[model samples]
Target: MPQLDKDLISQPELWSLVMQLSDRRLTAALLPPVDGEQMILSHIPLPVATAGSYAKAVEEAVYDNPLLLSDFSRIGLLTSSPRVALIPACLDDKAAEEAFEATFGSEACVSLREPTWREAVVVSDDDEQLLAFFRRTFFNITIRPTLAAMIECYRADGLWVSCEDAVIRWVYNLDGNLMAANSFDISAPEDAAYYVAALRRVVGADRGTVYLRRAGASREWCAAMADMLRGASCPVEMVNASPAICRLGHSGADLPDYFLQA
Candidate 1:
């Protein structure tokens, strides 16, 4: 089995993770981000009240039971008040717990973590921001690692990029696991070469990661191209003629089905 690891941005929604499971056997409660709004994918937009409140939001709201599964209408939590399901780390738990007790009178309401920033340039706004955010967040997690250490970590990382007419989408892994995903352009053949160059230049040539393109291009074409990359001293692995990678939406994109196995 592929060793499963969730690329957690913070300990927040439990349902999002459950839904992402390729097995689709698990279920969970979807909690509202600090604002009391439920969001399955995407950042828990920084809370409104204040940074302090945002911090608190992460702590107190997450819950343990009666995991919210479908939309509110489906579950009908409005008719019956079950324990509030919240993001574990969407807010600072220590702070949220203070609010939880102040309001709910205990540390019991908040739940645990869920697996889930900014810019730079080469210089498109999207790519720039994506790369910089990955760099920044990765460091934030590593703390005090020198450039060499960071490079050592990055060299092992990989990502997926595709465009047919404009851009089907692009997704990247900050760590070895899927960490972020996004859509760009529409879809086009032009996107194919552009994305490949970006992966080669931006991600660098040494990662040993594979790139799978779905340009309605031929397998003979893509495979031969992969072979050429090797001739250029670049390591290119498998190439899927189909658009399997793009099917992963927010969670799906970031964490491709059978991605671990790939």
Candidate 2:
């Protein structure tokens, strides 16, 4: 419920840019899942950032130096055994802090900073061995930021849920950064409650929008989700569309980056 203008960059300008950027296609290799396992996380270039003037700002604000000591822990599997990880963007402060703890434990410091209008959450992790190594050589400490910190920079205030093989929901900001994500079976009653609960955690008693993927399987389950959210008196506006399109009655032309083959 707090106003984001004070901590964030120009919301109106960022939203306008995101809308325009969502239309372009990203140039990432489409690697198929190996051994029945798909990569859990991917870093893709925002095609719209290729436009004039926006490129430098996007890189400087959201993608800064790392807060981690080394890549051995986080990217060890990038070449041999990669797994995809999705993080939703629309989280309350507590949820966001908890997520940071999950990754860095007590070995790091988490901080949020906004340059211009884009807010970037950074993690400064200095593992002992790495610190000793750097001090022995350059006499300086090394701090690297995790992907979670970079994603948090998006500062999404809304939630976006969609279904693919199973039910996968992502919290995203209007600027199109996905902050957090979870997957589950929509057919199960417990799952339905879980979905509602997730939304509740994000929106609380406030009104927000929910999107059900426009697949046939999503209709009935999504209807159930809408019903439960309404029952709890949460003013939710549900839309049936590809995750790219969360708002109803849009031009249906733009394809969101999530739908890309990265």
Candidate 3:
């Protein structure tokens, strides 16, 4: 039987640890169920370049652990690799496909089609590490509840990003539907301009309510991104609450099925 060391963690503390580990590039994380049917986030240290092997290890780790098999439903992968692309529903399938191919090649990691948006979760890291992981383990292993959950956590959407030393996360209510996700490298000076441009292109001109989450150390980067969004006329709110708190409290929190439906 495979055994994973479990710890009972509070919402606040868990977010702190997420930020810390994200800084170290342990982008993908697991939220395992604990007593009382609660969930506690956990991470296994796997360097970005070793994602393929990491996925194999995860398969082995959950091979016999019923708790992991039942509870480890969602996996969050943080990367500064291939940036994210969000295609609006307005685009026809052909146009959407072209746009996705142009931004990210055919070997994108996570591709999700929603009623309102089509997202390409591209992994642009060296040697296509994430792509190999997906091909070797993602299909064979049952990870997320659906493709939506996979990208929501596993890839970069408007929701989250883990840059060099900080993770910038966002959640938004879009036309009565909420999409929250995060990815990295968007805040770094070298990467910020491209990230901002991609973000604006995906979101377009909309009256969406958005909330930003980041560590204190990441305040500057977060503010920079926020300022850029506002410049593009995005109605974004830099909330005082932590990302973990917001994610855990809300009904669709933690990438639950309710969130996907919403």
Per lDDT, the best of the predicted structures is: 3
C-alpha lDDT (0 to 100) for residue 262 of candidate 2: 9
TM-score of each: 0.28, 0.34, 0.42
Better of 1 and 3 by lDDT: 3
Regions of model 2 farther than 4 Å from truth: 1-157, 172-190, 202-205, 240-257
lDDT for residue 1 in candidate 3, whole number 0-100: 22
User: lDDT, candidate 1, residue 179?
Assistant: 39
Task: Give the lowest summed-lDDT range of ten residues in model 1.
Answer: 117-126
97-130 per-residue lDDT for model 1 (tens digits): 5554565455344332122211210000112232
lDDT of 2: 0.35
TM-score of 2: 0.34
Highest-scoring model, TM-score? 3
Kindly give the number of clashing pairs for every candidate.
Answer: 26, 24, 12
Candidates in descending TM-score order: 3, 2, 1
**Candidate 1 local Cα displacement, residue 248, angstroms:** 16
lDDT of 2 by residue, 1-262 (tens): 2111233322221121110111121111111222232212223344345444334432322233121122111111001001123323455556756666676564333343112123333323323342343334322322222223223322345655544323343444544533343334455534765665665566441455554433223456556666776677655565434333333123321222233210
Question: In model 1, where do residues sit more than 4 Å from their true spots?
Answer: 1-157, 162-168, 177-180, 186-190, 204-206, 213-233, 239-262
The lDDT ranking, best first, is 3, 2, 1
Q: Which regions of candidate 3 are displaced past 4 Å?
A: 1-3, 6-39, 47-54, 57-66, 71-83, 105-110, 115-165, 170-212, 215-238, 242-262
